[model samples]
Target: MTASHAPFIAACTELLGASHVLTHDHDTEPFLVDWRKRYRGNACAVLLPADTAEVAAVVGLAHEHGVAIVPQGGNTGLAGGATPDESGAQAVLSLRRLNRIRGIDPHNNTITVEAGVVLAEVQSRAESAQRLFALSLAAEGSCTIGGNLSTNAGGTGVLRYGNTRELCLGLEVVTPQGDIWDGLRGLRKDNTGYDLRDLYIGAEGTLGIITAAVMKLHPAPVARVTALAGLASPHAALDFLAMAQRHAGALLTGFELMSDFSMRLVGRHFPQLRYPFGEPHAQTVLLELSDSESDEHARALFERLMEQAMEEGIVEDAVVAESLAQSQAFWDLREHIPLAQAEEGLNIKHDIAVPISSIGRFIEETDAIIARATPGARMVTFGHLGDGNLHYNVQAPEGVDQKQFLEAFQTPINALVYDQVHAHRGSISAEHGLGQLKVDEAMHYKSAVEVRLMQSIKAALDPENRMNPGKVVRWAQAGTRKENIA
Candidate 1:
């Protein structure tokens, strides 16, 4: 290690014992690599702070040493938001040691938890208390609440309960200057000023390190129903989704759309799962309903909607879950899509969102463009249709070298997809934050004034640019600070 980094490591190890501070290359390897194994990094050390106080201390030490700090959670983010760079100058500040649920207020319908707590653990804790923490994701078992909050994660439940930003009530953060900002409150009606908590919500650690959060909760649904329906096209899926929403209203918790290619990959990768339908339909819509009333009523309502959709030619065929186990099995198929795609082959994935009314058109036009641009390329599109987000992916033709295909078509494919999204007034990124993965792409879509405003905010908050530099916002233009405030 360099002479300058020696003191920083010593201070981190002193504040959090040697066991908590990982300096050995082998120990810090996992934190340096992203989940997709696409980007690898090098860190001077890895600091595991046990609590908010320890986090503050670590931040203070890093600030004193003028060393950059990269905050990381469970590291399950699709974007390279949590992965450190290969500078070997930054210290990875891991929040895993702060995994603790502080309090659960049933009367107020809220729960306070440290940022390091896993998403699934929070859900389980809420379930234990007869309440529901509704942020559901495929990586719930590993992704931490901090990372979710940082990226403003959206998943299946967003149709009913909204995204991570909607679920969050408050956050406790350690600023770049080493001061703790205690904004943790469970109040639902705090109409104070600019809502500062939101600034760091999707900042991806560029603004500060999130230590804990107070999240909203809801009463557990007493009844639930799930259904799988086959449709002729994306337009049909949209039509069915609208019909289901009109019937089920707020009880409609999920509306996922999958293409025929997506189902084929799932069936091929996961043979244990039995297809709900006998024939391959062009599109599939997975719907879920939840209510405090009778589950039979919910099931019947779904069935009637499907029947009406079929009569209207919006639905080709449908299968309602007959039992609770069947409902879970259907959901299992939807949640395992990413894994199945991985097993199939290397692919280029885009997590994008458009207007609900424009999604059908977007898919139709984009598919045609993709086919024309790269003949024989397979398109696997699926995601929370209710939220207007789709995981549109592209797979190379059979017998083609994956690397060569990506090299030849990745840029053109992205141009075609993003152009449509931009034309339709859609966001380049739906749920995932603008990490290093989309730093340049975001610039293409965002205006210079908008980018400048974001950079101004970053400079105002973190003048030194020592917190996750070169992340969501470009920090290269942030000139050197004249003074140290802290």
Candidate 2:
């Protein structure tokens, strides 16, 4: 340990016990890096705070010492949001120990949970209550509620429900100044004064530490029907989505887009799972219909839509999941694309979004752009088609060095894709919040006034920029003092 951080580490050890404070390189290495392995950082220590009070104490101590904090949960983020910087002065605050579901009120349909609560556990608890916690993602097994809320995550359910911001009613946040804001109101209507709950939700921990949250819940779906349909192109896929929306409407809970290349990669990597389609198709849609009525109703709605789609030539081939196992298998194919891509090689990933109408053009143009620019680069494109978010990723060619391709083309490809995204009035980041990966890009695409407003918010909340520095909005311009405060 460095001589300067000795007392700070000792104070943390004193507060949360010596065992809870990790200073050793081996003990803290995992927490220092992001899930993508794209960013590896260094920290003076990792402090595990067991509860809200403990977290408050940790924040207070860090504030007193003027030390920055990088609040991390599960370490499953892709944008390097949780990882600390190369500077070894910051402290990685681990929130994994505060995994508690405080309450579940069936009448009000709300679930109060600690920040460190795993997303899958919350879903299970909701199911036990005969309700549903709608915020679900691929990382639900390990991703924590705090991280999800911090990122304002949008998963497949976003089509029917909403993002984490809409899922959450209130939050228990510890401000950068170490003061607790117990605004955990379960009320659906609160029009009094400024909405402080929102300020912390998608701030990516740059404003404050979200210790717990009151999340909105919904009545459990009595039935769900899953289907994988083949399409000739993204244009056809858009038409398919439009037709599904017209037929099923709100019951059409999910509509995911998967390129043929993405499905091919999955098939090549994982042979055990049943592939979605046998023949070649340019694009496919993983659509689902859910209802609070009976299974027959959901199946009837899905079948009617599929029949109409086939007649209209929107769907070339389709498979309806007759059983729960079949439905899960269909989802399994969609969920494992990232795993398959990882198994293939280093991938330069882009979490992007465009209007549903423009998605076809977006894909066609970007696909051509990537192919023409980078020869033989494998494009794995898939994501929440209903809500317009796509995980458009790229892999090096058959024999190109993965690292070399990423190093050479990462910048230009990002610019090309993001430029097209902005040109189409789309977002560079839709579901995944702008972490370290796209902060600079955010400043670029975002208007000067908008960026200034955001910077003012961050500076107002955290004057010293001690809270999750360099992830969302970093300190711009000289002097640490807050000038022209909002």
Candidate 3:
């Protein structure tokens, strides 16, 4: 669109070949739009590099041209982290071409993979070697490992294995200045100064483009059991989780909380899925157990725990999967929440996290607050209860215009939910990074000092603000000068 953008596009094309450079409107359209379709941006072009060297070359070219570069991986991010701004001066660097699993060391319990490798592929590869890649998510089929690491993705397995940041042993990144930081080491313990790998893990691509990563892996569980438990209330669900954790210990892999609304949504949207319980309880907890021991032993242990929980009044009812097929079906119901919600209608979602102990109270109070503020709003809450993260969503009441409700109550509703999270010392963004969606709102809760420190780090790493600008860090010259301001 601009007379000056010709050279920038030309440079990118020269670095990544004409085939790899996507300048046509049709070719770059998908990269410009976000997953939620909430934001649409304009990028001059999209660059697809085949390897780390080519990525470094393309990033170097963009740096020299003084054009912004938005690093994208599968474009599966919930927040618009990969979407460029409206300026049309940026180029989206797609990592899809770099899909490769370089190495899997079973003895070392690590896997080195390219950023573009889909999460499901990584899991499968690990499984093939009798190992387990525990970082699991609903979007694993399409979400790229690079995007997962960039967002520091947390899913059900996070309760046992940890987030992407913890799973990542090292990363190979192309910095804003076009320099490649080859820090891809699989060391179990490295006390080298400054954990630079972490800086880009959840930076949302603002710092650099992750080309590849050395990820941790675990031994495949020989035995596994899945249980669906009915609870009296959110408090009861938490009590069940505490009791289960006390008995199951590290074997308790996943503890998810689902409300009655969530179950109805699933049953309505996914008719194929039969409700495990005959009657709708106040809440449900999908509990998972995994061990290297025998399957029978694992199932017996889970059954015993469930019986004990029922006797203690922690569990209203429970069902332990007798077979692997049954176990997967239970997980299918839990993992399909997003899909089910999508089919139902428009809703405002808050992926908030609170203290484990305060989650029950927070949910009760927040539900009451939401009902009072926005009457007729249907609350659908569920998520990794063990980790204190909840997909607290508010659906527009029946026969109401979704857009109008969103326009009127989005901010207020978010504040209401987030305030409770803040009060409980929880995170507004539990798994998703602060992309364009929450950049401004994050300021309201984060302290001036904390914001300044983040800004300073961004300025220090990406002074020109060419790498995924206008993300995690607020990029104003005045704001960058933290010391001068205060």
Top of the candidates by TM-score: 3
lDDT accuracy of residue 96 in candidate 3: 97
Query: In model 2, what lDDT does residue 278 have?
Result: 76
lDDT of 1 by residue, 308-426 (tens): 98898889999998898999889888877888988878898999999998988999899899999988999989999999999999999888998899999999888899999999999
* Number of clashes recorded per candidate: 0, 0, 0
**What is the lDDT of every predicted structure here?**
0.89, 0.90, 0.89
Compared with the true structure, what per-residue lDDT tens digits does model 3 show for residues 414-481?
88888888899989899988898888767667887787778878888899989898887677655644
The C-alpha TM-scores of every prediction are: 0.97, 0.96, 0.97
Error of 1 at 23 (Å): 1.1
1-486 per-residue lDDT for model 2 (tens digits): 578888889999999999999998999999998998889999999999999999999999999888999999989987999999998999999999999999999999999999999999999999999999988889999999999999999999999898999999999999988899999999999999999998898888999999999999999999888999999998898888888888888888899999989888888998877775779688878988888899998888888888988998889999999788999989998999999998998988899999888888988899899999998988899999888898989899999999999899999999999999999999998877888988878877877677778878877889888999998765764322232121
Q: Listing every candidate in turn, what is its Cα RMSD in Å to the true structure after a full C-alpha superposition?
A: 3.1, 2.4, 1.8
Single out the weakest 10-residue window by summed lDDT for candidate 2: 477-486
Error of 2 at 151 (Å): 0.6
Residue 483 Cα positional deviation in candidate 2, in Å, after optimal superposition: 14
Q: Please give the lDDT score at residue 48 for candidate 1.
A: 91
